[model samples]
Target: MRRREHESLTAGPVCPSTRSPRYTCRKLECVFSLGHPSIARLLTIKLGSGHAACIRFNRSGDLLASGRLDGTIVIFDIETNGVARKLRGHTRQDWKCVLWDLQDGSRLRTIRFTAPVFIAELHPNTHLKFVAALFDDQPILVDATEELVVKRNFQSAPKRSQLDMDEATEKILAQDAKQTTTVTTFSPSGDYIIAGTNKGWLNIIETASCQTMFSTHMAGGVITLLRFAPGGRQIVVNSSDRIIRTVHFPDLTGKNVDFGNFRLENDHKYQDIVNRLLWNHVAFSATAEYLVASIHMNHHVYVWETAHNSLNTILEGPTEELSAVEWHPYKPFLAAVGIDSGEVHLWSVIAPQKWSALAPDFAEVEENEEYIEREDEFDVVASEELTKRILRQEDEDIDVLTIDPVKGYGDHQEGGFKMPVLLHQDDEDSEDEIEAIGAGQYRRKSPGRGRDRNTANEATHQNGRR
Candidate 1:
């Protein structure tokens, strides 16, 4: 048996600068800044039924695939911008993970975990082979191409009796749950395969012997995702508890001295559920460099840089439900899923408008006088209007605001008042100018209002309704 000698450290969320909110970095002095582009729009790609859980893209960036609750895999051809093919295999209730071969789209694999899947990943060298784990069970390495099992091991899993939380005094083997909720890929060298479970355990396995090399408990919430740096010097894991942690592993040939092997140094925790996470999340200036992640149930995406260990920007919007999110392989653009409605939103992670951030500036005035006055008026209007709309639900005469520019604001426009929609123009000025410009600049682009305006006189003679 070869003895391992090495030290490991885990650093909490990379706070390039000391800031407030304890876990989060301060804004002005904050080292990490995620820039946003001028234009932002939620692009909708319709996937028929069942909530989409996970998605993967092929290497060429032409094919997009997603696994759904209905135990089916849907593939989309970006060139056609439509659903291309559907693959069926998992008979399980819900599909949890899917891996699309970057080198070859035909070589794909999907996992349907009976219990929630803790982690899943493909070997860096070969997409045909993949590994996944559930809870404290053994990791399953499958031949993706053939859908055959390659190896399964239970040696690292703790006995069922050891899971008793009350048995603190008992000396039991350790189990790793950190970075377990999501599968992780290893360095190109394939030196180590790490898995973190929901229970806060981290298991680092050596590929050579296919044995558990290091196991430790990462004290955070559920590890949602795990990613290794490009050169393989560091490893990152995030949990639903809003904590992002980095684990350091020395280069490949640097002697296997176990530098305590399991050291968790720094971590950053936030106040939300960590959702979709990715390495090289965004690309700026034609060079790809950014770590992007979205909160599971929230409408915000975080951008971090691996070089400096800092947050770059935050892109937010898209309320219903966020299922899967990923960055454009060669661009700073991003795409996310609204699971419930099957709405796909495309956003630029760089140079956001910062309109959402300016809310605090007008929040007081809006809350004090102007907001109070409108609140009373809006209440009466919305109540009367909403009541009528609800009653007319069965009838097609119901007129509802499909997409309001000021969605939650209580400023209900007057009846028949045409409003301009900035949706057509990708670039809208800052919030201040947008408000100062007034409603005149907003032109109503309602579904049926166009043709009638140009041919109003011509159609007036034939149609009596006008």
Candidate 2:
């Protein structure tokens, strides 16, 4: 990843109270609420009963899939601003992740585990592979292509009974508890799998055969979330330690590399030291140059520049607590769900650009200004000789857009246009005629069509003049 320069967007946000509606009349735009600060609110998909737990954007970004706390998943179409599909699973079933076909909202397959799964994600390239983290066991990779084949990604930790019992029992139990993986995710390229344990250890595993490539202890608290930058090299880890760490891997190519020398060589840590805010969720920007995390109970979202690891800007909006923030894949847009209202709050600065920018007296307005026309606005009186017409008498027939017609795609003979006409053989006055408009182009003339439309119009104009 290219290192971005230390930059600060320290512009103080417009407070929610003093800010006007519509967010207009401002040069440097600020965050606005939708139905509740957004300049252009695209969509607001509300869940039926419970709050949204997680949200993800489709590859093209025209659709949003949000999982609600009520065990229902809703796929929304942004263009229509309507719900496209609602999927529900795990009503009676437990300890399993059921994959569903979105097109018909039908269950495709289900992968069950002995232990409670904290999170299970399918490989980006193929749905047949799964990387799952268990509550009291190490993370494992499963090949669901045919049968239920599982492979433990990390080496099994030696049981405490096998070690010398010099330490206290409570201390030993605590140490053993940290051995299980709490969160796991596949790297951006799907070649490397990463798992975060309750003990704060980060393990990198090979996706092909589930081998441990690199392992390191990152924090003392449990690692809850792991997100990779758009680039495969850098990754951001969210843990219970109240700090977000962005780690940089040595390899750039997704091909096979020497894992024996793999290491967590470079990583940056970010935290709210002043307020000691607990981050709810963390995500990267579209370009992965900045990191954004929501506060526990705060309405603002903190953004930090990955280059200098300094605070860039604080997104201030949404009175209720914000959770599960998702950045649009290819835009400066962001969507955050409110904990209290279940409303998906959208934040974007894409204001309406119009020809008003060229007008010197243009101004932004909340409501349309009333227009009063003058009495002589449409009145006209003209009795002047045409100077241009006399200057260029032949200019009237000149077509500036004079260009050859393009060949039609459906049907055309070799290098020419040929149109056929049907005639009855009983007609005695029928005469064989053909009109050649261009080189190798012919039109079978109609018997009754003696004159073209322009020629007939010219004859009528002469009679009118006479």
Best by lDDT: 2
Q: In lDDT terms, how accurate is model 2?
A: 0.60
Most TM-score-accurate candidate: 2
Taking all chains together, each candidate's TM-score versus the true structure is 0.52, 0.63
TM-score of 2: 0.63
- In model 2, which regions exceed 4 Å deviation? 1-50, 147-178, 252-256, 356-466
Off by over 4 Å in 1: 1-51, 94-119, 143-149, 154-168, 171-184, 253-289, 305-311, 348-466
- Model 2 lDDT per residue over 201-231, tens place: 7877777767666667778688888887877
Q: Can you give the lDDT of residue 102 in candidate 2?
A: 50
RMSD of each: 22.1, 22.3
Which residue pairs collide in model 2, if any? 32-37, 32-38, 33-37, 33-38
> After TM-score superposition, what is the CA distance of residue 238 in candidate 2 from its true location, in Å?
1.1
